[model samples]
Target: MMTIERLREEINKIDEEILSLLNSRASCARQIGELKQKNSLVTYHPAREKEIYRQLLATNHGPLSYDTICAIYTEIISACRGIESPLKIAYLGPEATFTHMAARRKFGSSVEFVPVASIADVFAEVEKKRADYGVVPIENSTEGVITHTLDMFIESNLTICAEILLEISQCLLSNSSLEEIRLVYSHSHAFAQVRGWLKSNLPTTKCIEVSSTAEASRRAAMEQDSAAVGSELAAQVYHLNIMAKGIEDRVDNYTRFLIIGHSMVGRSENDKTSIMFSVKDRVGALHSMLSPFNKHNVNLTKIESRPSKDTIWEYIFFIDMNGHIEDDNVKEAIDELRESCLYLKVLGSYPVAG
Candidate 1:
């Protein structure tokens, strides 16, 4: 039988081997980066990242969970990518918000994160080349869509390079005890999600609406007898105690965020395409616009409508479809779709979030 001392020695040897391999990988990444820069190619590739994850996960027969392996590789990949090219990512701001969390999850901690005040600012950062990419919330499972984010896409020329699905776990953070808490601060959407829990736990506490959960945490940290409903990260950033955790009323709450950049992502094994269009002024035009996808056997994952803002009562339709724009079925479907629409735009084709 192996002794404890021997097992530790073996583990240390394996750790050294890992360190050596990581350094080799970093060297290779730097070479690739140089080639990409010489060729004028983008540093980040969503399809390649997805391919790496897929290949690793497929071969994994592990003592650790898939999530654990992915988390470990995420940091390693981030570090290697940083050695190649240091990236600056813009996100909806005052860090510790859900958008910030989503941005971190997508790009990892190696990148510089710039937190802007609004979704439009995130777009501006990327559009002006101040940031390499931008992350913004596009929709929520419980709250439908972020109309402002959708609206920004109509005017901005940025493409959706990737999507991130973040499970939202709201927490109550404060310096005071539950009994001593007299006020609560949170975003309006957050308050709506945890309404039932707050009603039962702190009925008399007045809930003040703020721009974001991080801001709420900041306010709670400064004010006496006040608590904030936010993320665990916010609690750490603001130095507040987690008075209550998993406080959201629903268990399945999730928010989807989009990574916007100038570079268009190439097709992956599993790809999704997003498009925006406006139907012509004719009865059955909207219905006719969707018929092509069914006719071409193309799958549409989601469809949403927002006011054209160009014309009153005229709506612009956004659709998320199942394949890359390069695919035959998708190409055919869009070709047919344009006949019924006054305007159409292919936002991007990217790897679907796992």
Candidate 2:
């Protein structure tokens, strides 16, 4: 058996080799980026990324799981992206928000991060090309949907390139002694999700609404008599003590985030397509819009409506289906829906998460 010193030496050699290879890979990527730029092509190619991950997973030998390998490669790719130009990613922020965490998980630490004030800002950044991509929350298992994000999607031309599901754990943070806490601050959604827990544990504490959980954390960090209900990451970001952890009423809480970019991605075997459409204002109009999916045997994963800002009492329906737009059945269904709708837009077709 090798001694500890020998193992350390081997690790150092491997590290040096990895670094050398990475530099070579980055050089190639830079050349590729230059060529793409000459042709006026987009930087992020979701289809290529999906293919790379699929091939890597197929050839993977254990010791590291497929997910672990994919994660490492994602970081490596993000670093190589700088050879083209550092990708600017916008997220709902004030740092340590779940959207920030999702951005990090998806793009790694190499991309330049922009902390935007609202979901609309996130969409606008990508739409205006100020950022290469933007990350925004779309839905939560417990709270249903982020209506603001969906509303923005209906009006934007941006495409969904990827999706990430993050497990949420709401923590109670305070600078005060637990017994001295008289109020708790958090976003309204977080409060609603944890209402039962708050009522049972801190009935006397007043629940205050803030712009965001990160903001709530900041408030709790400053006020000795107050607590903030937020993520564990928010506590660390704001330098507050955790008075309680996992305070959300639901243990299975998870939020789904969408990665939006300027162009549509190529198709993948495991892909999902998102679209928005407005139906005619008549009885069974909505039913007519959905019948095509049933006829074409397309699996509808989600459907939600938001009031159209363009017209009063008129609404836009956002639909998520479990196949790429390139699929024959999906194409047929889209054609049929388009015929029935006043306006329709196929947002994007992108790879599904493993």
Candidate 3:
């Protein structure tokens, strides 16, 4: 049998090798970053990162699980990218908010997180070249799409470079016991998500809506008889105790966040393109326009409509399809789609959320 000391020695050798390899990787990344800056190219390449993740996961034969390996490499990539300069990620935040969490999850700890006031501000920051990228909530599993985020895309001149799917787990945080909790604070969305649970558990607790979960946590931390419904991170940030965890009514609450940037992302191994179009006013016009997708054998994952803020009674159709914009079939389908439409816009083509 192998001795413990021998096994440790082997591990130490591997550790030294990993350290050397990481520094070498970071040096290469720095060179790439310099080239990118010289040529005015985008440093945060989502497609390249996605491809790396795909390759690593495919070859990962582990004592560690798939998620563990992914997480490890994500940080490794983040660190390498930071060697040039830490990417500034603007997110909707007060801090400890879900969007902030998603941004951190995607970019890892090596980057900087700038908290913005609203979704519009997130777009403005990226558009003005202030933030390297902006993350905004696109949709939620339980509550459906965020209209404000969809609305911002209408005129924002930004592109979706990546997508983040964050599993939202709400916690009941308080300084006092459940019975002692008289007032509950959280964002309106959180309150809505856990309304059923709240009604059953703390029927008389005064529920107040706050700007963000971080703000709610602050209030909870200050108040003697208050509780907050948010993440465990929020609890930690504000020094509140987690009274209960996973308190949302639905077990599978999830929020999808979009990474927005000035430039378009290149195609990844598996890609999804988002597009929006306004149809001409005619009977059967909408039906005829959609046929091309089916005829071209393009698979549309989602279709949503928002009132065209430009014209009254008119609507814009936002579509998510299972291919890149550079694909021949995708191009053909869009060309066919444009023939009957008043206006068409490609939002972005990016790697589908893992």
Candidate 4:
């Protein structure tokens, strides 16, 4: 009983309304950008960005899924943010690496992505301001912490602006058939992730380490009888066939990446604070440092200790707690901690990964 012309007419009207509303939003964003510029403020605000997503998700009632809604807004924000200033980001790369994927997930496809060779390089790019920000892998749910990233934090003055949690699924990519894969190539981390699968299926294949998964794909694409363990993005980039998908030993693998920048993120509704400090090498010393977090009623989400690299057995502890650095209880707790620690550094306070 419904007329197609009537439906088409309604859709046309809706399209005009959508365009008008988008322009209005862009105008407002540009005005905000002018104010930020006048105030000498950084154009990219991860805390405000997180709040935008949170508010949108809370209001969304859909035929569209949560991911779909997020994707729509990500590009919209990215485009409008570009009008204020286009962001240039560095990531651990040859391109198509998980860190690269995480960077894209946060900033969207509208901005520039620069691929650097090492975790240190990623840090350097942000520190030198060659790149506005950088994304580096910090830890994997499967293989544990990236010590290099942790080490970089010890020296680099950059703050952790945000964190990204990516669900990692590797693919076996090759130009030839399974029978032809005589050698396996992957980053050392990637090999660790899918070691059991390689041992079970291609035990006879000689495995080699590369700088990154993307680098492995590059080698595999050129070398005969070689396959790469990498993201599906790598397969597409190199025009290689994905002989097997989700080839990792563990299916539930996840990796956490950190966004590093010169400026720290402001407080968000839900936040996590990370800090590093060294305590006297004595009994109950570590306990004395952590006591304030308990006294302040803060929940400690993560804690890690790395050797100070200056003296034997001397170490600095890194703690991530639930709450912003600006929060009264968190500030009181950290100040209390300062008395016990020989040296203290607030690494960052950012919105917790949703």
Best by lDDT: 1
Candidate 3's TM-score: 0.96
lDDT tens digits, residues 95-123, model 3?
99999999988999999889998999999
Clashing pairs for model 2 are none
Ten residues in sequence with the least summed lDDT for candidate 4? 148-157
Ranking by TM-score: 1, 3, 4, 2
Q: Rate the local accuracy (lDDT) of all candidates.
A: 0.94, 0.90, 0.91, 0.90
Candidate 4 differs from the real structure by a C-alpha RMSD in angstroms, to one decimal, of 1.6
> Which tens-of-lDDT digit does each residue in 1-354 have in candidate 1?
999999999999999999999999999999999999999999999999999999999999989888998889888889999988999999998999999999888888999999999999999999999999999999888888999999999999999999999999999999999999999999998998999999999999999999999999999999999999999999999999998889998999999999999988898999999999998667887888999999999999999999898888789999999999999999999998887688999999999998
Scored by TM-score, the top model is 1
Per-model C-alpha RMSD = 0.8, 2.0, 1.5, 1.6
Error of 2 at 313 (Å): 3.7
Per-prediction backbone clash count:
0, 0, 0, 0
Error of 2 at 279 (Å): 1.8
* Candidate 4 per-residue C-alpha lDDT over 1-354 given as tens digits, one digit per residue, 9 for 90 to 100: 669999999999999999999889889989999999999999989889998998988999998988999989988999899888889999999889888889888999889999998898898888888999999998899889888888888887789999999999999999988887899889998999899888888889999998999999999999999999999999999889998889888888999999989887898899999998898899988887888888889999888889998889999788889998899999999999998788998889999897
Candidate 3's C-alpha runs over 4 A off are 1-6
**RMSD after Cα superposition, model 3:** 1.5
Off by over 4 Å in 4: 1-13
